[model samples]
Target: MQCMNWKLSDIASVLAVEVVGNPEALIQRVITDSRIASTGDLFVALVGERANGHDFIASVIEQGAVALLLTQAPKQPVSVPYLLVEDPVTAMQQLAAAWRLKHQLNPVVLITGSNGKTSVKEMVRAGLSARDGTGVLATQGNLNNHLGVPMTLLSLRDEHASAVIEVGANHVNEIAQLGPLAAPSVAVITSIGRAHVGEFGSLDNIKRGKGEIWQALPATGGVAIVPVVEADSEFDGWSFWQDALAKHHVIAFGDMANLNVNRGWQAWVGVVERQATTEGQLVRLATSDWGEATLELPIAGAHQANNCAAVVAVLLASGLSWQSIQTGLSEAKLPGGRLRLLTPLPDLLIIDDTYNANASSMKAAIGVLMEQSAKTHAFVMGPMGELGDESQALHEQVVDFACEAGVNAFLASGSLSRSLVQRFDVQRPLADLAVASEDAQRLAEALWQVYQQKGSMAVLVKGSRSARMERVVEALVKLASQSAN
Candidate 1:
């Protein structure tokens, strides 16, 4: 964080709050948690579900916070300056919005979509940072909400040439409200899928919510990066993205032939040539300005090819060379809990994609598992949450894929996992039995026994965040380690 040195009067004026402290006092830092407050920090006392920051006013003041941003004035006498507003959170957003504009941070990228938002964000950060003497600021660890966005903006310092902010929304008007705050120079919609369909009601609504990022771009000089889709894709067809973003420059990425580069639109045309010796894929990317190159991504799944293509588009929009993009992507690391490969035992390969799950991601992970040459392939899956009415059918559909994908054995856990087990019929098809357990630990034990009897197999572990499916990975790793010792 660069030295903000914002005056008390400036903060109060931006928030329209009543300032009671020395007006000339400069605040070098903005903090929400009292525990992190220092001498020159402005601590925001927000009201949350578990605890109210208002209760810790005295504690923050003692910790050397020069000023306080509060929704309500404290009951006791306070020595430091305090700005009382109707909502501390909104005030923080306003301050961040003002700060971003004042600094005029160039080439800010705002990324949103149903899936691959984090991966794209990390890729952009990696791609940009790999450039000579480049400093980037991004949302830390999936902090993509209203509060998280503002905190990210506040972290923007003078040295930061670019900022990659991930904006996530489950309902209507959420992303719409966030767009104005960030005011990104470039907006990216990774892909519109059935994620959070329960909250948005349908794919159309999801597209509408995600499109808000494009709407948030500046009137004259903004750019939009979107996935190239088929002519009759479900979400892209109704999105009318070209019409919605008619004013801004649009860059699309996907299949080389399918991408619509006509009518002055730019494209990152690419294809996954083949899977590499590593558990990764080789992609050939070609843009108008930056010529073609075969990039090796140390990540699994064909879906990643498109995700990396989107990153390529973002980088090209930022004026990066093909070589730079390749270097950054090659060095980019996929975060844990998302297609992360682990080897606990000599013959056992664990794909720990347990971060979150939905129908599309589930199928993608399963595809990666089946792509492997392991003699036996197994899946430890949990219920995909927030799928609404289609949750049961989606769960069943995944199991059908498992059965047809040549999965040797599998275990289903969580409330919806029972759907897969109930749908499984050994009499009709596969010789192996599908285990149905209520939780990860139980499934781990059963899976361990299967591995004991079967020997040498690849395991794919995945589920939604609510399922905490990473626990299954932990359990299996522990069992393997004990046996190894």
Candidate 2:
């Protein structure tokens, strides 16, 4: 694909910025980091929580950046062209919108939810790319937030046959802002759960935030793929979603047979059957729209069934044949740091799901680890962040389920780990539990000892982003390597 170019003067007019040096300079790329800037790239100076991009203006200019997008006038004289605006971040979003409008992309899919957003986005990309002559682009990694969404949109080139963008927000009105910028042809809400309950205050508020994606759809027409929520779910009375999205086509995918059918509503009822395999598991998905098909998913977790189903719904709505959808699902792979299995030793297995966590994901990871037939099953976890007042209670519930599942040990770390360790009095009879002293390597050593004792062991490591539970996965691999040597 050829690089997308925007004239400095055109970008300034779009962003309402004043051009300083060469207004005619052509910007072929947009980059935020000075370390990654190339010739003809427009360096956007973003003020972030930890670092300020303005601090590296000279560095990026020296590295051949043709122009700069700045929030303020440069402190030092620079030979490169530049544009000054009120806010570089907002300017970046406006610039991306201008580019998206210029390209007029079709079948752009915007996905958001408390969980499964990334997985569903990746799955959709896989399904789209499986079609002959289709070029697909997606948000790289967890770049689903405000700034990241703009970058993803701006990265879209003319060659893309489809684009799958992940829209993420923790608080109210956040998705509302991103939705218009994306203006997706299809909007997908994978599921609403307690991912950031602390920020939103309640699940109802989260539903309001997630529903903003559908609200962003053009009044002309669009498609919305949402899960058929159960009666006991926190989002039971989300019928308002239909009213808000009345102008659009809405499709529902889930296990429920009695899905609330609203005006212009189409539903794909499906059920998942899981069977254990030595590598991962086999999932048989029987859906009303596409009929029955079994897939060998290399990743472990029952939640994957829902994620795949959401992908299938979107692909089918996009008018792809069921044969292509099946081929795509068979080739789907979860991004790293999710429920990925690692066999560092012949007798040891690690279910590394350290990408991020919450109440729902924690239980799902434990379920996958329990699928193992190892003599000892252990869970290494950290605190689920953004849970505010209920953090302690949620931690307690996690341990309770871990014990009820008959795991041999619950190896935990983080600020909330103490909650599980303190409950050992009642848990000791059911299983062993301990909290690490904030040292991941030390925790890995203790877990390694537990695994060594049992002839075969399977360990599930998971936590929120702040907890960096992936460190434990790394530590275990390092220790296993040292022992082998």
TM-scores vs. true structure, each candidate: 0.95, 0.94
Evaluate residue 163 in candidate 2 and report its C-alpha lDDT on the 0 to 100 scale: 84
lDDT of 2 by residue, 46-142 (tens): 8989998899998888888999888878898999888878877788788777787776566789999888888888778888887833578789998
lDDT of 2: 0.80
Those runs of model 1 whose alpha carbons end farther than 4 Å from true positions after fitting are 132-134, 260-264, 426-428
Per-residue lDDT for 205 in model 2?
87
Estimate, for each residue in 162-207, the C-alpha lDDT of model 1 and write its tens digit: 8889999988889888878888999999888888898888878888
